[model samples]
Target: MSDTQNMLNDFRWIMDVVQNIDVGLVLLDKNFNIQMWNSFMQNHSATLAEEAIGQLLFNLFPEIDEQWFRRKTQSVYILKNSAFTTWEQRPYLFRFENYRPITGKAEFMYQNSTFIPIQGLNGEIGSICIIIYDVTEQAINNLELEKANNQLEIISKTDGLTGLLNRKSWENLLETEFQREAR
Candidate 1:
C-alpha cells in the first residue's frame, strides 16, 4: 500500500478507537463550540454527534453552572495545561444518567473530568479536549463507607440498649469539658 493510504488507515483506526471508548470524549474550540463528540457522549446524552457539533457547550448543557465551568475551561486555555474537576466539586457536567446496575443508587452519573489544552501547529492554544469519566461507583462506595464508619464510631461510643454514651465515653467528654471550663 502507498504511504498516504497507510496513513489514512491509521487515522481511521484511531478514530474508531476514540469513538468506541467507554468514557465521554469531547473536543471544543476556543469559542466553546463542540468540534467532536464521541459515541459515549451520544449514548449517554441521547444526542447525536451531528446535533451536538458546532453548538456551544453551555448551549447544549444549559443546566451547567456556566460561570464555574467557563472559568475552569478558561483556566485550561490561559494556563495551557490540564485542569480537573471531580463529582464532589461539581457533579456531572451534562446530567447523564448512571446506567451501571451496581451503581444504580445514583440518579445521575458522577463525573470526574479533565480539561486538556490542545496546542495548535503554531504552538498556540487552539482547542480543549474534555474527558469525562463516570465515577458513580467510586463516589457511592465512598459515601456508603463514610456512613458505615460513622455508625461504627457511634456504636463504639454509645450503649446499644440505652442509645446513650457509654461510661468511658461519658467520662472522657466530661474530663475534656472540665478541662476546657477550668482553662
Candidate 2:
C-alpha cells in the first residue's frame, strides 16, 4: 500500500478507538463550539454526534456554570497546558444519570474532567479537548466512609449510660466556653 493509504488506515484505527472509549471525549473550538463528540459523550449526554457538532457547549448544557467553565478552558487556551477538576469541587460537568450498577447510590454520575489544549498544525492553540471520567463509585465510597467515621466519633464522645458527653469531651467543651467568656 502507498504511504498515504497507510496513514489513512492508521488514522481510522485511532478514531475508532477514541469513539468507543468509556470516557466521554469532547473537542471544542476556542469559541466553545463543539468540533467532535465521541460515542461515550453521545450516550451519556443523549446527544448525537451530528447534532452536537457546531453547537456551543454552554448552549446545549445551560446547567453548566458558565463563568467557572470559561475560566477553566481559558487557562488551557492561555497557557497551552492541561487543567484538572475533581468531582468534589464541581460534581459533574454534564448532568448524566449515574447508571453504574455499583455506584447507583448517587442520583447523578460524579465526574472528574481534564481540559487540555489542542494544538493546531501551525503550532498554536486551536481548541480544547475535555476528557470525562466516571468517578461515582469512588465518591460514593468516600462519602460512606466519612459518615461512618463521624458516627464513631460521636459514639466515642458520649457516655453510654447517661447519654451525656464523656469526661474528656465535656472538659474540652467547658474549656472552649471558658475561653469565650474570658474573651
Candidate 3:
C-alpha cells in the first residue's frame, strides 16, 4: 500500500478505539460547545453524537452547575495542564443512570473525570477533552465498608443485650471525665 493509505488506515484505527472505549470522551471548544461525543457517552446519556455536537454543554445537561464547570475548565485553559476530579470530590458531571448489575445499589453512576487541554497548531490551547470513567463499583464498595465499620464500632462499645455502654466503654468515659476534671 502507499504511504497515504497507511496513514488513512492508522487514523481509522484510532477513531475506532476512541469510539469503542468503555470510558466517556467529550471534546468541547472554548465556548463549551460539544465537538465530539463518543459511544460511551451516547449509551449512558441516550444522546446521539449528531445531536450533541455543536450544542452547548450546559444546555444539554442542565444538572451540571455551569459556574462550577467553568471554574474547573478555566485553569486547564490558562495553564494548559490537566485537571482531575475524583468521585469523592464530585460524584458525576452527567447524572447517568447506573445500569451495571453488580452496582445496582447505586442510583447514579459515580465518575472520576480528567480535563485535558488540547493545543492547536499555533501552540495555543483551543479545546478541552473531558474523560469520564465509571467508578460506581468502587464508590459503592467504599460506602458499604464505611457503614460496616461504623456498625462494628457501635457494637464494640455497646452491650449486646441491654443496648447500653459496655464496661470498657464506661471505664474509658470515666477516665476521660477524670482527666478533664483534673485539668
Candidate 4:
C-alpha cells in the first residue's frame, strides 16, 4: 500500500460510521503515556495525538488522581481490571462533556470508559488500550425513558400521592436506615 493510503488505513475505521461518533479512543503504554490518540480524542481532549505522545500520566492532566494512576499502571503492567470514577466518583478524569477552561470548548461526552491490556510480541502486556464510548445522550438523558412496568414491581397497594409504602415502604425504609445508622 502507498504511504498516504497506509497512513489513512492506520485509522480509517472511523469512516465506517455515518454520523460521526462523539466517542474517543486512546492507546496508552504501560506507564499510561499516550501512544495513539484518534481524531475524536484530539478534538475532545483538546490535545492532538502527536503533541501528547511520550508524556507521563501525571504530566498529561493533574486532575487525574494519584489513585487512578497507581491502579492504571498496575493494570497495564500486571493484567488486572481497574474501574474508573465517571460521573459520581471522579468527573474531571473523563473531561469529555466539557471543554478545557483554557480552550473554552466542549468536545464530546462519554459516559463509559474501559481500559484493556495490550499484549506485546512476547505475549506479555506491553500497553493498555483506553476505549472511551460516548453514551451521555443514551445514558443520562434517556435514563428514565426505558423504564418499563415489568422492571419495577407494581405497588397497587401503595399510596399514589407519595409513591411511598403506605405502610410496607415506610417500614422497609425506616428499618434499613435505622439499621444502617445503628451499625
TM-scores of the models, in the given order?
Answer: 0.91, 0.87, 0.95, 0.57
Question: What stretches of model 1 exceed 4 Å from their correct place?
Answer: 101-103, 178-183
* True-structure Cα RMSD, model 3: 1.2
Checking candidate 2 for backbone clashes, the offending pairs are: none
Q: In the order shown, what is each candidate's alpha-carbon RMSD?
A: 1.7, 2.8, 1.2, 8.2
Model 2 misplacement above 4 A: 101-103, 160-162, 167-183
Please give the CA lDDT of all the candidate structures: 0.91, 0.93, 0.96, 0.63
Sort by lDDT, top down from the best: 3, 2, 1, 4
Please tell me which predicted candidate would have the highest lDDT against the true structure. 3
State the displacement of the C-alpha of residue 100, model 3, in Å, after optimal TM-score superposition: 2.9
Q: Write the per-residue lDDT of candidate 2 for residues 72-174, one digit (tens) a residue.
A: 8888988888999999998999999867676279999899999999899999999999999999889989999999999999899999898888998989999
lDDT agreement of model 4 with the native: 0.63
| Candidate 3 lDDT tens digits, 54-91 | 99999999999999999999999999999999999899
For every model shown, the clashing-pair count is: 0, 0, 0, 0
For candidate 4, write residues 132-162 as lDDT tens digits: 7765545544444545443454454377787
Q: Looking at model 4, report the run of 10 residues with the lowest lDDT sum.
A: 83-92
- Residues forming the 10-long window of minimal summed lDDT in candidate 1: 94-103
